[model samples]
Target: MNPSTFTVMEGEDNERIDQRLARDMDVSRTAIQQWITSGDVQVNGKEIKSNYKCRTGDIIEVVPPPEASPLTAQPEAIPLDIRYEDDDVLVVNKERGMVVHPAAGHASGTLVNALLHHTDALSDVNGALRPGIVHRLDKDTSGLIVVAKTNDAHEHLAKQLQTRSLTRLYIALVHGNVSHDEGTIEAPIGRDQQQRQKMAVTNVNAKEAVTHFSVLERFSEHTLVRCRLETGRTHQIRVHMTYIGHSLVADPKYGRSRSSPLAGQALHAETLAFIHPRQQEKRTLTASLPADMQALLDNLRSG
Candidate 1:
């Protein structure tokens, strides 16, 4: 997979050196810059800077790197509700009450553990504890999640998420009916200074966060809503919903009315969409709400 060499004639060049090389070689500008930095790209058969202008009669040598497998794939006997799996990625339906990864208070039986058991290869970008975790659902949230199997896959998926190219949608039953049929929560989210355990919309040490939601079903005192995330932040959905005066039903920490029947928050990650890391095509994955949450909603609707 090494890049091929090219001869630049005096009167045929008409673009920036990097752009020209990228177009001529069918590569990316970033890749061309990388070659220049590594001294593998040269003008007139000699090493040149990335910004070097091309002249007529210049011989350009491009040494493309060898294509190697991104990581080692291993198979382990871990139980998983696999929604999708390919050479570069996987999708899993995470059950309600399942932690994404192991933490101090909890270890083993986590989604990571299952992944390790199910597949041997996962991107090391997030370290050993988290192999392929690009985005995360809360410990109590159940839904579909995409996982990367290699470094290239990890980088590609991470970039999509950072650029807001990915779509994450959730369904939740809140304590009260919303006043509006649809609304957007354009609020910044940051760590709570007073309480480290909570996230809040504040000006200090914050990042931009936005949530768009529409009502799905309305109960006498509860509302089921579908929320889409435009920006990812820690505890984003929970925090934004609480800030807007309708905390998720059964969320003990944020509930205002306090007449709770469920043991945990009634939230579910219903759908996720992103570009395929290897195929470069868009893909969407979905999952049904866990039985407990579904039953809770049913009971709410009936009562």
Candidate 2:
């Protein structure tokens, strides 16, 4: 077992032991709490829970295993389109069909596996299955994603997401020309009672979800639009778009009919913005439409 120790300094009194340990030790609050639960943390030589109030001159110790395995991480040489990289964060333009991380059947060739092969360390806030993942896009929906490399960065970014301070924008192609040039969808999203696998805009076990959109281009049978997310939920844009009379052009399950010739949902994550976790500066990034999506748009424009 590898052991680590930390000393509480002046001005740290009155803070919760777990919180302070998370900040000072560069580990997740959950990780620190786990140590406390296992009697791996002590205050003034006495084992205590994470909620214990910390005082100055307190001595804390933690014992961790020598190595941590990425539960489903397999080293794959999959090429990644890294948009930006810094000491604390990495921005990636994930292609369609690539799972963000491993699940039951998808244990290999995932983005997490790629990350494990590329980088040496990642934050453990979400658990072994998701290392450094701040947010996620659907498997078929491709676009910008931000990953945190350290616990400090993870905490900061997670807080931003919780407070809805992060900006996420997407572009999509939909069937039919929408009547409204721009509008907002203010609906509560919850699990579908009838279809357990999907989300719906109803009050049953629901949370608030908001999306703002503006039409960008119009064709004979399709329209392109830019969308911004105010509240991120599972299938917010997809469900809301379908609810608002313009289901994205290739969504199989929600729309009136599955697309015959078009590819999977025409949505793409086009923009992302947030405060830098370590640098504390505002950061904004954008990704152009993927080739297949652009080709479809071109065909729609010409026809």
Highest lDDT scorer: 2
Against the correct fold, how does model 1 do in TM-score? Answer: 0.73
For candidate 2, write residues 181-264 as lDDT tens digits.
999999998778798568889986678899999999999887899999998888899999999888988887677675445457
Off by over 4 Å in 1: 1-78, 257-261
Off by over 4 Å in 2: 1-71, 260-262
Best by TM-score: 2
lDDT of each: 0.79, 0.82
Q: What is the lDDT of candidate 1?
A: 0.79
- Show the colliding residue pairs in model 2: none
Q: What 10-residue stretch in candidate 1 is worst by lDDT?
A: 67-76
